[model samples]
Target: MEPHIAFEDISKIYSNHVTTVAVEGVNFQIMPGEFISLVGRSGAGKSTLLKLLIAEERPTQGRVFFEGRDIATLDGSQEISSLRRKIGTVFQDFKLLSNKTVFENVAFAMEVAGKNDEEIAEDVPQVLELVGLSDKINNFPHELSGGEKQRVSIARALVHRPGVLVADEPTGNLDPANTFEIIRLLLKINEIGTTVVLATHNKEVINTLDRRVVSLDKGRLVKDDPRGTFIL
Candidate 1:
């Protein structure tokens, strides 16, 4: 099968008074249904790599391909929207609306994607259950614990049933117990066939994952280990 996601000779440079190289000559391919841990130190280009994969930023050179199509060349809003819909994203920050309840938060994603009220009502509850948030569906962000908030975030990301899930520092704010729970949830998501790209600096998280490790240092691809540990 073709790669679900591929980065070919990728590089990103920001020019200001002085130039900054975010990532350079990075190449990797993510197969369908695989779990990958993107490991690196702070400012090690993890964010830049994800931005390129999602087309949030154009690489200064090279290409990002999703399922055999070059994403950088997609300039139309419809095309971009369609591409993004296939790749769900979860971040360290929950990014939930303060006033929205858990149910509404997850439902909002479907709404934004033009899902009808009927579909939202049907799918939102199921995703909340998947993320083990059925009990907190009516709770507000402030009312939930950090782990619960993150679970809601994961639920929202999965509501789309995207083919790929990109999680950036997802457990950054959680305690050890919560961190482990979140990692377990991510593994469960991966087991069911969503290609997961997890970008984090947590050594223990990477070590315990025993998944594919793609390490970056000073903006360059340094290692690609199939069952790797975090050594950065």
Candidate 2:
């Protein structure tokens, strides 16, 4: 089967004053419905790779294909925008709108995607429920706990039934209990068939993932294993 995401010999270089190579000759494929983890130390190019995947940053060389279409070949701003709709992202800091109610926050994502009132009304509630935040829909980010805020972020990400969810250090700020809750939710999402890609520094979380683990050191892929542990 063709992979949902393929990073072919990906490499990135930074230059302004002095040149720096961030990622070098990295190749990987993310399969649909798979739970995958990328582990590495600080400034190890993990974040750079994620940014490249989301098109936040362009690769200096190499290509990324999403379902066989070169990501670089996306026709225009509109096409790139549409591609993003199929991908959801959760960050270490829950990027929720401070003043919006949880329901409105999730609803806003669909609204921007041109979803009509009926669709937004029906889907937002289901996603909120999936993230265990149905009862907190009316609450603002300030009114919710850290875990609740992350759940709200997760719900917003799921509102579109994205084909893949990329969570970058999602549990970085929360305590262990809350971290585990987020991890459990990611696993649950994977079980339901959305490919999950996690980039994190937390060893315990990565070790417990029990999934395809890819370890990156500096800019190189040092390890790739089916039943991998977090050895970063």
Candidate 3:
């Protein structure tokens, strides 16, 4: 079978007046249901790789394929939307809507996807329960703690039941205690068969995972360990 996601000799360069190479000749394949962590320091191209995967940034060379379709060639908005639906993303910032309640925040994902009210009602509660935020459904972003807000973000990301979830520095804003909570939640999500691509610089968090680790340094892939730790 084909890989779920593949990057073939991919490279990205940003230029206007000054030229900056974000990623160079990066190649990897993520299998279905695999839990993989991308480890790197700042400016190591981790974010560029994640952006390439979701087609937020186009490659300067080579191709990024999602389930065999080259993302660079995906020209239509409909196709891009379909691709995004299959890949959920979470960020360090909770990115919650201040005006909406927790339930509404999660439901908004499905709502914009054209899901019916009944489906949104059924799925929102279930996803919130998964993130341990069922009781906080009526709360808003300002009403929750850092960890709780992140949990709400995770719930919103999972509402569509995507095949792969990409988290970029998800624990950056949390305390150590809350960091572990979020990691455990991601692991649980991976356990139930969602492929997880976690991009983080946290040594303790990466060390604890003990899963596949791909290390990047200065826009190049440095190492890939099957049972890896965070080594710089």
Candidate 4:
């Protein structure tokens, strides 16, 4: 079977005055419906790898393939937009619009994708329910707890029903209890068949997962473990 996502000999370098390598010849493949974690210390190139996958930043060398097509070659905006629609991304920051209500925030994603009122109305509530934010749909970002804000972010990300969800440190700002709650929600999403790629530095969360761990060291792929732990 083919991998859902593949990084073939990928490398990224940035130069202005002094040159720095963000990722170095990293290669890995993520299968469909799998939950995987990318573990590394600060500045270990984890973010760069995700950026390459999303086409926010291109690889200085090699290619990133999603379902077989090389995303690096996707020059057209529509092509890139189409690829992004199939993948949802969550970041450490909630990235919620402070002015929009919970429902509007999630609905905004569908609206931007050209979904109509009826579709947005139906799908927004469903995804909000999935993230345990149904009752808070009318609430603004400032009116919610940290966990709730993150849930809203997740809800917005899932509004498109993406095949793959890339969460980069989704629990970074939450307390331990809330952190676990968010992780459990992610696990539930994975169980329901969304491929989840989580990049985190939390040892307890990573160790507790005991899932596939892709370890990176100074921008290089150091270890790929099926039942992996957080070892830096």
Query: Over the stretch 152-225, how does candidate 2's per-residue lDDT look in tens digits?
Result: 88888888889999898999889999999999999999999999999899999988878899999989999999
Residue lDDT tens for model 3, 134-220:
999999899999999999999988998899999999999999999999999999999999999999999999998989999999999
* Model 4 worst lDDT window (10 residues): 82-91
RMSD of each: 1.1, 1.1, 1.0, 1.1
Give a tens-digit lDDT track for model 4, residues 5-29. Answer: 9999999999989899999999999
Backbone clashes in model 1, listed as residue pairs: none
| Candidate 4 RMSD computed on C-alpha atoms after optimal superposition onto the true structure | 1.1
lDDT of each: 0.92, 0.89, 0.93, 0.92
TM-score of 2: 0.96
Q: For model 2, which pairs clash? A: none
lDDT of each residue in 59-151, candidate 1, tens digit only: 999999999999977978888888888888888987888999999989977887889998999999999998888999899999999999999
Candidate 1 stretches greater than 4 Å from native? none
Model 4's TM-score against the true structure: 0.97
TM-score of each: 0.96, 0.96, 0.97, 0.97
Which regions of candidate 3 are displaced past 4 Å?
none
- How does residue 20 of candidate 1 score in lDDT? 97
